[model samples]
Target: MASRMDRAQAVVAIGELFREHGYHGTSYGQITAATGLGKGSLYNHFPNGKEDMTRAVLAHVHGWFEDNVFGVLASKTDPMEAVDQMFVQVDDYFRSGRRLCLLGAFSLYDVRTAFDAEIVSYFSRWVETLAGCLKRGGLSAKESKVQAMACMVDIQGGLLMAHAFDDAAIFTSSLARSAKTLRAAMGDRVPA
Candidate 1:
Protein backbone atom coordinates (compact mmCIF):
# COMPACT_ATOMS: atom_id res chain seq x y z
CA MET A 1 0.00 0.00 0.00
CA ALA A 2 3.02 2.31 0.17
CA SER A 3 4.83 1.62 -3.05
CA ARG A 4 4.13 1.99 -6.75
CA MET A 5 2.56 -1.13 -8.21
CA ASP A 6 1.88 -2.24 -11.73
CA ARG A 7 -1.35 -3.98 -12.81
CA ALA A 8 -0.17 -7.48 -11.86
CA GLN A 9 0.88 -6.37 -8.42
CA ALA A 10 -2.41 -4.65 -7.95
CA VAL A 11 -4.31 -7.78 -8.94
CA VAL A 12 -2.39 -9.90 -6.46
CA ALA A 13 -3.12 -7.45 -3.67
CA ILE A 14 -6.75 -7.24 -4.72
CA GLY A 15 -6.93 -11.04 -4.70
CA GLU A 16 -5.66 -11.25 -1.12
CA LEU A 17 -8.09 -8.55 -0.12
CA PHE A 18 -10.95 -10.39 -1.77
CA ARG A 19 -9.92 -13.60 -0.13
CA GLU A 20 -9.87 -11.96 3.27
CA HIS A 21 -13.08 -10.14 2.63
CA GLY A 22 -15.64 -11.74 0.37
CA TYR A 23 -16.57 -10.06 -2.92
CA HIS A 24 -19.53 -8.27 -1.39
CA GLY A 25 -17.56 -7.35 1.70
CA THR A 26 -14.73 -5.64 -0.14
CA SER A 27 -14.96 -2.02 -1.24
CA TYR A 28 -13.01 0.08 -3.71
CA GLY A 29 -11.72 2.16 -0.83
CA GLN A 30 -10.24 -1.02 0.65
CA ILE A 31 -8.78 -1.95 -2.71
CA THR A 32 -7.20 1.45 -3.11
CA ALA A 33 -5.77 1.13 0.37
CA ALA A 34 -4.50 -2.35 -0.32
CA THR A 35 -2.89 -1.47 -3.67
CA GLY A 36 -1.90 2.12 -2.89
CA LEU A 37 -3.51 3.19 -6.14
CA GLY A 38 -5.90 6.04 -6.61
CA LYS A 39 -9.20 5.57 -8.40
CA GLY A 40 -7.87 7.23 -11.58
CA SER A 41 -4.75 5.08 -11.59
CA LEU A 42 -6.66 1.90 -10.78
CA TYR A 43 -9.18 2.59 -13.53
CA ASN A 44 -6.36 3.08 -15.99
CA HIS A 45 -5.23 -0.48 -15.29
CA PHE A 46 -8.70 -2.05 -15.05
CA PRO A 47 -11.18 -0.27 -17.21
CA ASN A 48 -13.94 -2.64 -16.17
CA GLY A 49 -13.19 -2.06 -12.47
CA LYS A 50 -13.77 -4.91 -10.03
CA GLU A 51 -14.87 -7.30 -12.74
CA ASP A 52 -11.57 -6.97 -14.55
CA MET A 53 -9.61 -7.37 -11.33
CA THR A 54 -11.51 -10.55 -10.46
CA ARG A 55 -10.91 -11.90 -13.94
CA ALA A 56 -7.20 -11.28 -13.69
CA VAL A 57 -7.00 -12.99 -10.29
CA LEU A 58 -9.01 -15.96 -11.52
CA ALA A 59 -6.87 -16.24 -14.65
CA HIS A 60 -3.67 -16.15 -12.61
CA VAL A 61 -4.94 -18.82 -10.26
CA HIS A 62 -6.18 -20.94 -13.18
CA GLY A 63 -2.89 -20.68 -15.01
CA TRP A 64 -0.92 -21.63 -11.88
CA PHE A 65 -2.98 -24.77 -11.29
CA GLU A 66 -2.91 -25.63 -14.95
CA ASP A 67 0.86 -25.59 -14.98
CA ASN A 68 1.47 -26.97 -11.50
CA VAL A 69 -1.43 -29.28 -10.68
CA PHE A 70 -3.92 -30.16 -13.43
CA GLY A 71 -1.37 -30.09 -16.20
CA VAL A 72 1.00 -32.11 -14.07
CA LEU A 73 -1.69 -34.69 -13.45
CA ALA A 74 -2.70 -34.80 -17.08
CA SER A 75 0.79 -35.45 -18.40
CA LYS A 76 2.57 -37.51 -15.74
CA THR A 77 3.18 -41.15 -16.77
CA ASP A 78 3.10 -42.34 -13.19
CA PRO A 79 -0.43 -41.91 -11.94
CA MET A 80 0.39 -42.41 -8.28
CA GLU A 81 3.22 -39.92 -8.50
CA ALA A 82 0.99 -37.41 -10.18
CA VAL A 83 -1.69 -37.85 -7.55
CA ASP A 84 0.85 -37.56 -4.77
CA GLN A 85 2.31 -34.50 -6.43
CA MET A 86 -1.15 -33.05 -6.68
CA PHE A 87 -1.50 -33.20 -2.88
CA VAL A 88 1.92 -31.69 -2.36
CA GLN A 89 1.27 -28.89 -4.80
CA VAL A 90 -2.08 -28.21 -3.24
CA ASP A 91 -0.68 -28.20 0.28
CA ASP A 92 2.04 -25.75 -0.64
CA TYR A 93 -0.24 -23.54 -2.69
CA PHE A 94 -2.67 -23.16 0.17
CA ARG A 95 0.19 -22.45 2.59
CA SER A 96 -0.54 -25.52 4.70
CA GLY A 97 -4.20 -24.55 5.07
CA ARG A 98 -3.47 -21.01 6.19
CA ARG A 99 -4.53 -19.51 2.87
CA LEU A 100 -8.03 -19.49 1.48
CA CYS A 101 -8.67 -20.82 -2.00
CA LEU A 102 -9.71 -17.86 -4.12
CA LEU A 103 -12.04 -19.86 -6.30
CA GLY A 104 -13.66 -21.51 -3.29
CA ALA A 105 -14.09 -18.13 -1.65
CA PHE A 106 -15.63 -16.70 -4.79
CA SER A 107 -18.03 -19.62 -5.01
CA LEU A 108 -19.51 -18.84 -1.59
CA TYR A 109 -21.44 -15.75 -2.53
CA ASP A 110 -23.67 -14.06 -5.11
CA VAL A 111 -20.44 -13.44 -6.96
CA ARG A 112 -20.73 -17.09 -7.88
CA THR A 113 -23.51 -16.19 -10.30
CA ALA A 114 -21.31 -13.69 -12.08
CA PHE A 115 -18.25 -15.91 -12.32
CA ASP A 116 -20.11 -19.21 -12.30
CA ALA A 117 -18.49 -20.53 -15.44
CA GLU A 118 -14.98 -19.84 -14.22
CA ILE A 119 -15.64 -21.32 -10.79
CA VAL A 120 -17.20 -24.45 -12.28
CA SER A 121 -14.35 -24.92 -14.73
CA TYR A 122 -11.66 -24.59 -12.07
CA PHE A 123 -13.12 -27.28 -9.80
CA SER A 124 -14.29 -29.58 -12.59
CA ARG A 125 -10.99 -29.42 -14.47
CA TRP A 126 -9.07 -30.38 -11.33
CA VAL A 127 -11.26 -33.44 -10.73
CA GLU A 128 -11.18 -34.52 -14.35
CA THR A 129 -7.42 -34.36 -14.64
CA LEU A 130 -6.81 -36.17 -11.36
CA ALA A 131 -9.38 -38.79 -12.25
CA GLY A 132 -7.58 -39.36 -15.52
CA CYS A 133 -4.35 -39.89 -13.63
CA LEU A 134 -5.96 -42.38 -11.27
CA LYS A 135 -7.53 -44.26 -14.15
CA ARG A 136 -4.08 -44.58 -15.68
CA GLY A 137 -3.04 -46.15 -12.37
CA GLY A 138 -5.62 -48.89 -13.07
CA LEU A 139 -8.61 -47.59 -11.12
CA SER A 140 -11.86 -48.01 -12.97
CA ALA A 141 -12.93 -44.74 -14.53
CA LYS A 142 -15.91 -44.43 -12.21
CA GLU A 143 -13.84 -45.24 -9.13
CA SER A 144 -11.10 -42.88 -10.21
CA LYS A 145 -13.57 -40.04 -10.51
CA VAL A 146 -15.04 -40.92 -7.15
CA GLN A 147 -11.66 -40.81 -5.48
CA ALA A 148 -10.82 -37.52 -7.17
CA MET A 149 -14.09 -36.04 -5.96
CA ALA A 150 -13.36 -37.28 -2.47
CA CYS A 151 -9.99 -35.55 -2.51
CA MET A 152 -11.57 -32.36 -3.67
CA VAL A 153 -14.15 -32.59 -0.96
CA ASP A 154 -11.51 -33.23 1.65
CA ILE A 155 -9.45 -30.27 0.47
CA GLN A 156 -12.29 -27.80 0.43
CA GLY A 157 -13.77 -29.07 3.63
CA GLY A 158 -10.39 -29.23 5.30
CA LEU A 159 -9.70 -25.64 4.46
CA LEU A 160 -12.98 -24.65 5.99
CA MET A 161 -12.32 -26.66 9.13
CA ALA A 162 -8.82 -25.30 9.52
CA HIS A 163 -10.08 -21.76 9.25
CA ALA A 164 -12.88 -22.43 11.70
CA PHE A 165 -10.79 -24.27 14.22
CA ASP A 166 -7.50 -22.45 13.75
CA ASP A 167 -5.86 -25.85 13.53
CA ALA A 168 -3.71 -26.82 10.58
CA ALA A 169 -3.46 -30.40 11.79
CA ILE A 170 -7.15 -30.82 11.12
CA PHE A 171 -6.49 -29.95 7.53
CA THR A 172 -3.44 -32.18 7.48
CA SER A 173 -5.45 -35.08 8.77
CA SER A 174 -8.16 -34.44 6.19
CA LEU A 175 -5.61 -34.68 3.39
CA ALA A 176 -4.13 -37.82 4.94
CA ARG A 177 -7.55 -39.37 4.99
CA SER A 178 -8.04 -38.50 1.36
CA ALA A 179 -4.67 -39.91 0.44
CA LYS A 180 -5.41 -42.95 2.55
CA THR A 181 -8.56 -43.57 0.57
CA LEU A 182 -6.58 -43.55 -2.66
CA ARG A 183 -3.78 -45.61 -1.14
CA ALA A 184 -6.31 -48.18 -0.03
CA ALA A 185 -7.71 -48.25 -3.53
CA MET A 186 -4.26 -48.61 -5.02
CA GLY A 187 -3.33 -51.54 -2.77
CA ASP A 188 -1.11 -49.47 -0.45
CA ARG A 189 1.50 -48.67 -3.07
CA VAL A 190 1.03 -44.88 -3.17
CA PRO A 191 4.17 -42.96 -2.45
CA ALA A 192 4.49 -41.03 0.79
Candidate 2:
Protein backbone atom coordinates (compact mmCIF):
# COMPACT_ATOMS: atom_id res chain seq x y z
CA MET A 1 0.00 0.00 0.00
CA ALA A 2 1.11 3.54 -0.70
CA SER A 3 1.99 5.86 2.18
CA ARG A 4 -0.90 7.96 3.47
CA MET A 5 0.69 11.18 2.21
CA ASP A 6 1.36 9.62 -1.17
CA ARG A 7 -2.26 8.53 -1.45
CA ALA A 8 -3.49 11.93 -0.40
CA GLN A 9 -1.22 13.72 -2.82
CA ALA A 10 -2.26 11.42 -5.64
CA VAL A 11 -5.93 11.96 -4.93
CA VAL A 12 -5.48 15.74 -4.86
CA ALA A 13 -3.53 15.76 -8.11
CA ILE A 14 -6.14 13.56 -9.79
CA GLY A 15 -8.93 15.84 -8.58
CA GLU A 16 -7.14 18.92 -9.88
CA LEU A 17 -6.86 17.47 -13.37
CA PHE A 18 -10.31 15.88 -13.37
CA ARG A 19 -11.96 19.10 -12.20
CA GLU A 20 -10.73 20.65 -15.44
CA HIS A 21 -10.56 17.85 -18.00
CA GLY A 22 -13.21 15.57 -16.51
CA TYR A 23 -13.18 11.81 -16.14
CA HIS A 24 -13.16 10.63 -19.74
CA GLY A 25 -11.04 13.54 -20.85
CA THR A 26 -8.38 12.87 -18.26
CA SER A 27 -5.88 10.18 -19.24
CA TYR A 28 -3.73 7.95 -17.09
CA GLY A 29 -0.63 9.60 -18.50
CA GLN A 30 -1.99 12.97 -17.46
CA ILE A 31 -2.71 11.71 -13.96
CA THR A 32 0.82 10.40 -13.60
CA ALA A 33 2.28 13.59 -15.02
CA ALA A 34 0.22 15.70 -12.65
CA THR A 35 1.43 13.68 -9.67
CA GLY A 36 5.04 13.63 -10.91
CA LEU A 37 4.86 9.90 -10.48
CA GLY A 38 5.76 7.27 -13.02
CA LYS A 39 3.07 5.14 -14.59
CA GLY A 40 4.00 2.14 -12.43
CA SER A 41 3.73 4.17 -9.26
CA LEU A 42 0.27 5.39 -10.22
CA TYR A 43 -0.81 1.91 -11.14
CA ASN A 44 0.47 0.61 -7.86
CA HIS A 45 -1.71 3.12 -6.07
CA PHE A 46 -4.68 2.50 -8.37
CA PRO A 47 -4.41 -1.07 -9.49
CA ASN A 48 -7.68 -0.80 -11.36
CA GLY A 49 -6.28 2.24 -13.17
CA LYS A 50 -8.15 5.44 -14.10
CA GLU A 51 -11.53 4.38 -12.77
CA ASP A 52 -10.12 3.59 -9.35
CA MET A 53 -8.25 6.87 -9.35
CA THR A 54 -11.48 8.71 -10.21
CA ARG A 55 -13.35 6.97 -7.40
CA ALA A 56 -10.70 8.09 -4.94
CA VAL A 57 -10.84 11.59 -6.34
CA LEU A 58 -14.63 11.68 -5.99
CA ALA A 59 -14.42 10.57 -2.36
CA HIS A 60 -11.78 13.16 -1.66
CA VAL A 61 -13.94 15.90 -3.14
CA HIS A 62 -16.99 14.70 -1.24
CA GLY A 63 -15.06 14.56 2.03
CA TRP A 64 -13.92 18.12 1.53
CA PHE A 65 -17.49 19.32 1.07
CA GLU A 66 -18.67 17.28 4.02
CA ASP A 67 -16.08 18.82 6.29
CA ASN A 68 -16.02 22.39 5.08
CA VAL A 69 -19.37 23.25 3.49
CA PHE A 70 -21.84 20.85 5.09
CA GLY A 71 -20.19 21.09 8.46
CA VAL A 72 -20.68 24.86 8.46
CA LEU A 73 -24.26 24.57 7.34
CA ALA A 74 -25.02 22.02 10.02
CA SER A 75 -23.44 24.05 12.80
CA LYS A 76 -25.68 25.72 15.36
CA THR A 77 -24.47 29.27 15.08
CA ASP A 78 -25.38 32.67 13.68
CA PRO A 79 -27.23 31.76 10.49
CA MET A 80 -25.67 34.44 8.38
CA GLU A 81 -22.19 33.62 9.58
CA ALA A 82 -22.76 29.99 8.70
CA VAL A 83 -24.08 31.00 5.30
CA ASP A 84 -21.00 33.13 4.69
CA GLN A 85 -18.68 30.33 5.67
CA MET A 86 -20.50 27.95 3.33
CA PHE A 87 -20.01 30.31 0.41
CA VAL A 88 -16.40 30.91 1.36
CA GLN A 89 -15.77 27.20 1.26
CA VAL A 90 -17.53 26.96 -2.08
CA ASP A 91 -15.43 29.77 -3.49
CA ASP A 92 -12.27 28.13 -2.26
CA TYR A 93 -13.25 24.78 -3.75
CA PHE A 94 -13.76 26.25 -7.19
CA ARG A 95 -10.79 28.52 -6.80
CA SER A 96 -13.17 31.47 -6.88
CA GLY A 97 -14.92 30.02 -9.95
CA ARG A 98 -11.76 29.92 -12.01
CA ARG A 99 -12.06 26.12 -11.96
CA LEU A 100 -14.84 23.73 -12.86
CA CYS A 101 -16.36 21.41 -10.27
CA LEU A 102 -15.34 17.80 -10.56
CA LEU A 103 -18.83 16.44 -10.02
CA GLY A 104 -20.43 19.17 -12.09
CA ALA A 105 -18.24 18.27 -15.03
CA PHE A 106 -19.08 14.60 -14.63
CA SER A 107 -22.79 15.44 -14.74
CA LEU A 108 -22.40 16.68 -18.29
CA TYR A 109 -21.39 13.25 -19.52
CA ASP A 110 -22.93 9.79 -19.69
CA VAL A 111 -20.01 8.49 -17.68
CA ARG A 112 -21.78 9.52 -14.50
CA THR A 113 -23.58 6.19 -14.55
CA ALA A 114 -20.51 4.47 -13.28
CA PHE A 115 -20.60 6.52 -10.10
CA ASP A 116 -24.26 7.49 -10.07
CA ALA A 117 -25.12 6.43 -6.54
CA GLU A 118 -22.19 8.15 -4.90
CA ILE A 119 -22.61 11.32 -6.94
CA VAL A 120 -26.32 11.55 -6.26
CA SER A 121 -25.76 11.01 -2.57
CA TYR A 122 -23.27 13.87 -2.49
CA PHE A 123 -25.77 16.32 -3.98
CA SER A 124 -28.69 15.03 -1.94
CA ARG A 125 -26.69 15.30 1.25
CA TRP A 126 -25.79 18.88 0.41
CA VAL A 127 -29.40 19.86 -0.26
CA GLU A 128 -30.70 18.16 2.87
CA THR A 129 -28.04 19.74 5.05
CA LEU A 130 -28.68 23.19 3.64
CA ALA A 131 -32.42 22.74 4.06
CA GLY A 132 -31.87 21.97 7.71
CA CYS A 133 -29.97 25.22 8.11
CA LEU A 134 -32.71 27.14 6.34
CA LYS A 135 -35.25 25.55 8.62
CA ARG A 136 -33.32 26.65 11.66
CA GLY A 137 -33.31 30.18 10.26
CA GLY A 138 -37.14 30.36 10.36
CA LEU A 139 -38.19 29.06 6.97
CA SER A 140 -40.98 26.52 6.97
CA ALA A 141 -39.81 23.02 6.14
CA LYS A 142 -41.29 23.13 2.65
CA GLU A 143 -39.98 26.61 2.03
CA SER A 144 -36.58 25.67 3.32
CA LYS A 145 -36.38 22.74 0.94
CA VAL A 146 -37.44 24.90 -1.97
CA GLN A 147 -34.82 27.44 -1.06
CA ALA A 148 -32.21 24.74 -0.70
CA MET A 149 -33.00 23.46 -4.16
CA ALA A 150 -32.73 26.95 -5.56
CA CYS A 151 -29.42 27.49 -3.87
CA MET A 152 -28.04 24.30 -5.38
CA VAL A 153 -29.30 25.30 -8.80
CA ASP A 154 -27.82 28.73 -8.39
CA ILE A 155 -24.47 27.31 -7.36
CA GLN A 156 -24.26 24.87 -10.26
CA GLY A 157 -25.50 27.37 -12.83
CA GLY A 158 -23.40 30.15 -11.38
CA LEU A 159 -20.26 28.08 -11.60
CA LEU A 160 -21.01 27.30 -15.23
CA MET A 161 -21.59 30.97 -15.99
CA ALA A 162 -18.46 32.01 -14.17
CA HIS A 163 -16.36 29.56 -16.11
CA ALA A 164 -17.92 30.43 -19.45
CA PHE A 165 -17.67 34.17 -18.91
CA ASP A 166 -14.20 33.96 -17.41
CA ASP A 167 -15.47 36.07 -14.54
CA ALA A 168 -15.27 34.81 -10.98
CA ALA A 169 -17.51 37.68 -9.95
CA ILE A 170 -20.44 35.92 -11.57
CA PHE A 171 -20.29 33.18 -8.95
CA THR A 172 -19.47 35.60 -6.18
CA SER A 173 -22.52 37.63 -7.07
CA SER A 174 -24.69 34.53 -7.20
CA LEU A 175 -23.57 33.51 -3.73
CA ALA A 176 -24.31 37.03 -2.52
CA ARG A 177 -27.79 36.85 -3.93
CA SER A 178 -28.40 33.42 -2.41
CA ALA A 179 -27.16 34.69 0.94
CA LYS A 180 -29.37 37.73 0.64
CA THR A 181 -32.34 35.48 -0.02
CA LEU A 182 -31.50 33.41 3.03
CA ARG A 183 -31.02 36.45 5.23
CA ALA A 184 -34.32 37.85 4.07
CA ALA A 185 -35.96 34.57 4.94
CA MET A 186 -34.56 35.03 8.42
CA GLY A 187 -35.97 38.58 8.58
CA ASP A 188 -32.51 40.09 8.51
CA ARG A 189 -30.87 42.48 6.09
CA VAL A 190 -27.40 43.24 4.93
CA PRO A 191 -26.82 46.86 5.80
CA ALA A 192 -26.32 49.05 2.80
Candidate 3:
Protein backbone atom coordinates (compact mmCIF):
# COMPACT_ATOMS: atom_id res chain seq x y z
CA MET A 1 0.00 0.00 0.00
CA ALA A 2 1.31 3.43 -0.95
CA SER A 3 0.41 6.91 0.20
CA ARG A 4 -2.80 8.50 -1.12
CA MET A 5 -2.64 11.27 -3.70
CA ASP A 6 -5.05 14.06 -4.51
CA ARG A 7 -8.17 13.18 -6.52
CA ALA A 8 -7.13 15.25 -9.54
CA GLN A 9 -3.75 13.59 -9.69
CA ALA A 10 -5.34 10.18 -9.34
CA VAL A 11 -7.77 10.97 -12.16
CA VAL A 12 -4.95 12.06 -14.46
CA ALA A 13 -2.89 9.00 -13.63
CA ILE A 14 -5.85 6.75 -14.26
CA GLY A 15 -6.58 8.52 -17.54
CA GLU A 16 -3.10 7.90 -18.88
CA LEU A 17 -3.39 4.28 -17.88
CA PHE A 18 -6.67 3.98 -19.68
CA ARG A 19 -5.23 5.73 -22.71
CA GLU A 20 -2.42 3.22 -22.97
CA HIS A 21 -4.55 0.22 -22.23
CA GLY A 22 -8.14 0.21 -23.31
CA TYR A 23 -10.86 0.12 -20.67
CA HIS A 24 -10.91 -3.67 -20.49
CA GLY A 25 -7.14 -4.01 -20.63
CA THR A 26 -6.46 -1.63 -17.74
CA SER A 27 -6.63 -3.16 -14.26
CA TYR A 28 -6.76 -2.05 -10.67
CA GLY A 29 -3.15 -3.07 -10.07
CA GLN A 30 -1.94 -0.88 -12.96
CA ILE A 31 -4.02 2.06 -11.80
CA THR A 32 -2.78 1.67 -8.25
CA ALA A 33 0.78 1.54 -9.48
CA ALA A 34 0.30 4.58 -11.71
CA THR A 35 -1.28 6.66 -8.97
CA GLY A 36 0.97 5.32 -6.16
CA LEU A 37 -2.19 4.91 -4.16
CA GLY A 38 -3.53 1.90 -2.39
CA LYS A 39 -6.73 0.14 -3.37
CA GLY A 40 -8.49 1.63 -0.37
CA SER A 41 -7.59 5.16 -1.41
CA LEU A 42 -8.83 4.53 -4.90
CA TYR A 43 -12.11 3.26 -3.57
CA ASN A 44 -12.41 6.35 -1.42
CA HIS A 45 -11.90 8.60 -4.41
CA PHE A 46 -14.00 6.59 -6.82
CA PRO A 47 -16.80 4.81 -5.00
CA ASN A 48 -18.06 2.91 -8.02
CA GLY A 49 -14.54 1.89 -8.95
CA LYS A 50 -13.37 2.30 -12.56
CA GLU A 51 -16.74 3.45 -13.82
CA ASP A 52 -16.81 6.53 -11.64
CA MET A 53 -13.16 7.17 -12.32
CA THR A 54 -13.72 6.98 -16.07
CA ARG A 55 -16.66 9.34 -15.88
CA ALA A 56 -14.58 11.85 -13.97
CA VAL A 57 -11.76 11.47 -16.47
CA LEU A 58 -14.13 11.91 -19.38
CA ALA A 59 -15.58 15.02 -17.80
CA HIS A 60 -12.10 16.44 -17.40
CA VAL A 61 -11.21 15.72 -21.04
CA HIS A 62 -14.53 17.17 -22.21
CA GLY A 63 -14.01 20.32 -20.18
CA TRP A 64 -10.55 20.83 -21.64
CA PHE A 65 -11.79 20.47 -25.22
CA GLU A 66 -14.79 22.66 -24.48
CA ASP A 67 -12.50 25.43 -23.35
CA ASN A 68 -9.65 25.03 -25.81
CA VAL A 69 -11.14 23.56 -28.99
CA PHE A 70 -14.88 24.11 -28.94
CA GLY A 71 -14.80 27.60 -27.45
CA VAL A 72 -12.71 28.95 -30.31
CA LEU A 73 -14.88 27.30 -32.93
CA ALA A 74 -17.90 28.89 -31.27
CA SER A 75 -16.37 32.35 -31.27
CA LYS A 76 -18.52 34.88 -33.19
CA THR A 77 -15.88 37.35 -34.31
CA ASP A 78 -14.14 35.41 -37.08
CA PRO A 79 -15.21 31.82 -37.84
CA MET A 80 -12.50 31.14 -40.46
CA GLU A 81 -9.78 32.13 -38.05
CA ALA A 82 -11.40 29.87 -35.48
CA VAL A 83 -11.29 26.97 -37.96
CA ASP A 84 -7.61 27.64 -38.58
CA GLN A 85 -7.00 27.77 -34.85
CA MET A 86 -8.66 24.38 -34.56
CA PHE A 87 -5.93 22.77 -36.67
CA VAL A 88 -3.23 24.31 -34.51
CA GLN A 89 -4.91 23.30 -31.28
CA VAL A 90 -5.54 19.72 -32.44
CA ASP A 91 -1.97 19.24 -33.61
CA ASP A 92 -0.60 20.58 -30.33
CA TYR A 93 -3.04 18.59 -28.23
CA PHE A 94 -2.18 15.30 -29.96
CA ARG A 95 1.55 16.07 -29.72
CA SER A 96 1.87 15.71 -33.50
CA GLY A 97 0.92 11.96 -33.52
CA ARG A 98 3.07 10.92 -30.56
CA ARG A 99 -0.04 10.66 -28.39
CA LEU A 100 -3.11 8.51 -28.63
CA CYS A 101 -6.60 9.89 -28.93
CA LEU A 102 -8.35 8.53 -25.87
CA LEU A 103 -11.84 9.03 -27.24
CA GLY A 104 -10.96 7.49 -30.60
CA ALA A 105 -9.27 4.56 -28.89
CA PHE A 106 -12.33 3.89 -26.77
CA SER A 107 -14.64 4.13 -29.75
CA LEU A 108 -12.65 1.38 -31.44
CA TYR A 109 -13.29 -1.13 -28.69
CA ASP A 110 -16.27 -2.96 -27.23
CA VAL A 111 -16.38 -0.62 -24.27
CA ARG A 112 -17.64 2.00 -26.71
CA THR A 113 -21.13 0.74 -25.93
CA ALA A 114 -20.51 1.37 -22.26
CA PHE A 115 -19.63 5.02 -22.77
CA ASP A 116 -21.80 5.68 -25.81
CA ALA A 117 -23.34 8.95 -24.71
CA GLU A 118 -20.09 10.63 -23.75
CA ILE A 119 -18.35 9.51 -26.92
CA VAL A 120 -21.27 10.49 -29.12
CA SER A 121 -21.59 13.91 -27.55
CA TYR A 122 -17.88 14.59 -27.93
CA PHE A 123 -17.80 13.98 -31.68
CA SER A 124 -21.23 15.48 -32.28
CA ARG A 125 -20.43 18.74 -30.56
CA TRP A 126 -17.23 19.20 -32.53
CA VAL A 127 -18.87 18.53 -35.86
CA GLU A 128 -21.85 20.74 -35.07
CA THR A 129 -19.68 23.61 -33.97
CA LEU A 130 -17.55 23.35 -37.08
CA ALA A 131 -20.59 23.04 -39.29
CA GLY A 132 -22.04 26.14 -37.75
CA CYS A 133 -18.84 28.00 -38.50
CA LEU A 134 -18.94 26.85 -42.12
CA LYS A 135 -22.58 27.87 -42.39
CA ARG A 136 -21.73 31.36 -41.24
CA GLY A 137 -19.00 31.37 -43.88
CA GLY A 138 -21.67 31.07 -46.58
CA LEU A 139 -21.98 27.28 -46.95
CA SER A 140 -25.39 25.65 -47.00
CA ALA A 141 -26.44 23.48 -44.07
CA LYS A 142 -26.03 20.18 -45.93
CA GLU A 143 -22.68 20.99 -47.49
CA SER A 144 -21.32 22.39 -44.26
CA LYS A 145 -22.25 19.23 -42.39
CA VAL A 146 -20.75 17.06 -45.11
CA GLN A 147 -17.48 18.96 -45.02
CA ALA A 148 -17.43 18.96 -41.22
CA MET A 149 -17.84 15.21 -41.09
CA ALA A 150 -15.18 14.82 -43.76
CA CYS A 151 -12.76 16.89 -41.73
CA MET A 152 -13.33 14.77 -38.62
CA VAL A 153 -12.87 11.62 -40.65
CA ASP A 154 -9.60 12.95 -41.98
CA ILE A 155 -8.35 13.82 -38.50
CA GLN A 156 -9.32 10.51 -36.90
CA GLY A 157 -8.30 8.46 -39.88
CA GLY A 158 -5.04 10.36 -40.12
CA LEU A 159 -4.40 9.55 -36.50
CA LEU A 160 -4.87 5.88 -37.23
CA MET A 161 -2.53 5.94 -40.18
CA ALA A 162 0.09 7.98 -38.33
CA HIS A 163 -0.03 5.65 -35.35
CA ALA A 164 0.34 2.66 -37.60
CA PHE A 165 3.13 4.20 -39.65
CA ASP A 166 4.94 5.80 -36.72
CA ASP A 167 5.09 9.04 -38.70
CA ALA A 168 3.95 12.48 -37.63
CA ALA A 169 4.23 13.79 -41.16
CA ILE A 170 1.29 11.63 -42.18
CA PHE A 171 -0.96 13.35 -39.70
CA THR A 172 0.37 16.78 -40.60
CA SER A 173 -0.23 16.13 -44.30
CA SER A 174 -3.74 14.93 -43.61
CA LEU A 175 -4.56 18.14 -41.78
CA ALA A 176 -3.10 20.22 -44.57
CA ARG A 177 -5.14 18.42 -47.20
CA SER A 178 -8.30 18.72 -45.14
CA ALA A 179 -7.75 22.42 -44.58
CA LYS A 180 -7.14 22.95 -48.27
CA THR A 181 -10.34 21.15 -49.10
CA LEU A 182 -12.23 23.26 -46.59
CA ARG A 183 -10.92 26.50 -48.09
CA ALA A 184 -11.95 25.33 -51.52
CA ALA A 185 -15.40 24.42 -50.24
CA MET A 186 -15.78 27.88 -48.73
CA GLY A 187 -14.83 29.46 -52.08
CA ASP A 188 -11.77 31.10 -50.53
CA ARG A 189 -8.52 31.36 -52.46
CA VAL A 190 -6.47 28.31 -51.47
CA PRO A 191 -3.03 29.47 -50.48
CA ALA A 192 -0.35 27.60 -52.35
Best by TM-score: 1
Q: What do the candidate models score in CA lDDT, each in turn?
A: 0.88, 0.82, 0.85
* Deviation from native of the Cα of residue 25 in model 2, angstroms: 1.5
In angstroms, the error of model 2 at 1 is: 23
Ranking by lDDT: 1, 3, 2
lDDT of 3 by residue, 54-118 (tens): 88888888888899888888885566777888988898988887777888888999888888899
Model 2 has an lDDT value of 0.82
| lDDT for each residue of candidate 2 in 1-192, tens digit (9 for 90 to 100) | 223348789899788888778777888777766787778878788999888888898898899899999888998466667777888888887877787877877877877898887789889999998988878777788998999999998888889999999999998888889877877876742222
Which residues of candidate 3, in runs, are more than 4 Å off?
1-4, 189-192
Q: Each prediction's TM-score against the native?
A: 0.94, 0.91, 0.92
Clashing pairs in 2: none
Better of 1 and 2 by TM-score: 1
Per-residue lDDT of candidate 1, residues 100-150 (tens digit)? 898998898889998999999999999999888888877888998998998
Question: What's the lDDT for residue 186 in model 2?
Answer: 69
TM-score of predicted structure 1: 0.94
Give me the displacement of residue 27 in model 2, in angstroms.
Answer: 1.6
Q: After superposition, how far is residue 122 of candidate 1 from its true place, in Å?
A: 0.1
